[model samples]
Target: MSRRTLVAGIGNVFLGDDGFGVETVRRLSAPGAAAARLPDGVETADIGVRGVHLAYQLLDGYDTLVLVDATARGGAPGTLYLIEAGADGPVAPQTPVLDGHQMSPDAVLALLDTLCAGTGAAPPRRIWVVGCEPGSLDEGIGLSPPVAAAVDEAVRMVLDLVHHQDEETPQDEPGVAAN
Candidate 1:
């Protein structure tokens, strides 16, 4: 069987650096670009600012989930991060109340977890984040220079991840836990 992967770009294009994910995915999906280079079973989507929609999409079942977004990890702008959401499961940290319009990657994962529990759907077996350090997420229409520069690199990283997973033999059925 083949591994199914979903590369979801999540962010708000209206915000400055917050649009990294959207931009990266846009580049990947461009004509004769990264999307054409991808292998079978790999899918991409720009889930811009719609966390609820992304959460529901997760229920569709994928072996691996790659979330591309601008993450504030206190690094210089354009710094890329590959974060493996631990095997333990989604971490739910107490945060200030959020409105319907905003949802961070962590929040989306938590929501997916809750929704999965209710629907009895299995969450993706592995979750990886291709995050970029943002220079600013202030109200604006475009990315900062550094963030814009990192889009191509982020796209490469995501492709590498998908290819790497494709080469590995699964130790268990896609999303099913092995004892």
Candidate 2:
């Protein structure tokens, strides 16, 4: 398979559940890292609180991209959402914070779109986001109970998507998927 899958966790570790993304990455990076079971081609990285930095990461050769973050939209805490990258969607503005570190996921997508347009190349074939609802984004450094519990589930969902994608695409030979 191709090493063209990038899973990024985005969040601020200083805030409570807002740190969900970073924490999830940590959990998956531990010795028994649960996310390690994901399909062999995909690579995961923690992009904690980096705004435009995500765009740079996207510059790497990746056919698919998945971003995990904590979203607050008045939903029940710990709710998980599978969001596609686009303009017309239910995901709200990325204005949750006022600091310079704040950057919209859409903006990153736009940057990729512009780059692809300029170069006459296709953008990431797949871009998905797993958003976890946060009960509190107050000044703190950990995830609440519910959000923490959903970490494993989120990892599983992403891996499942990766596997399904692999099965859908025809490989050159058996056990050989795009890399």
Candidate 3:
């Protein structure tokens, strides 16, 4: 099977702003939603702290992967970061700005890699992470105003990238495929 696209949101619902990713998915999955207009073959999921279960969704085969999460690295609130996985940097697990989830994003990715290796499957060709800096990650329940606003921007960024890729990729010619 060719690679499909997967958008996995990871976070903690109990923690304020930590639920940004899951909340985004929930918003996307609404009835008669605009998210339905997303490209065909693109699937989205809310995998809050359940990174181990990611293998099942990811196993199907996906070329592009987008992960949305709330992060804090001393940046301004609602800061958006588009980071490529396995880029030139140390893949260290950072301490959570707010203690709610059991595993960090990098740890989840590592677990996914281990699962893929054990099953002899290839990982996605591209992995983009969209991070929103949080104003609060406390033991509260809702997203801060700034972080909430960032979700719209994050969705737009992901959608634009997907459409761009769809346009750039060539279709099959006769019996030859670009892949």
lDDT of 2 by residue, 22-130 (tens): 7766666556757567667677788886766776667766888878888765677887776656536433444542233776676566666666677666667777777
The alpha-carbon lDDT assigned to residue 165 of candidate 1 equals 72
TM-score, prediction 2: 0.78
Instruction: State TM-scores per candidate.
Output: 0.86, 0.78, 0.81
Best by TM-score: 1
Selected candidate, larger TM-score, 2 vs 3: 3
Top candidate (lDDT): 1
Tens digit per residue, CA lDDT, model 3, 102-147 = 6677766666576678898777777767677889989988999989
Q: Locate the minimum summed-lDDT window of 10 residues in model 3.
A: 170-179
lDDT tens digits, residues 1-179, model 1? 77788999989898899999999988887878698988799888999988878888989888899888888887789888877775565477343224347677777888888889999998888888888899998998999998898888788888888878755432222221121
Question: Which residue runs of candidate 3 sit more than 4 Å off their true CA positions?
Answer: 89-101, 166-179
- Provide backbone clash counts, one per model: 0, 3, 0
Error of 2 at 19 (Å): 0.9
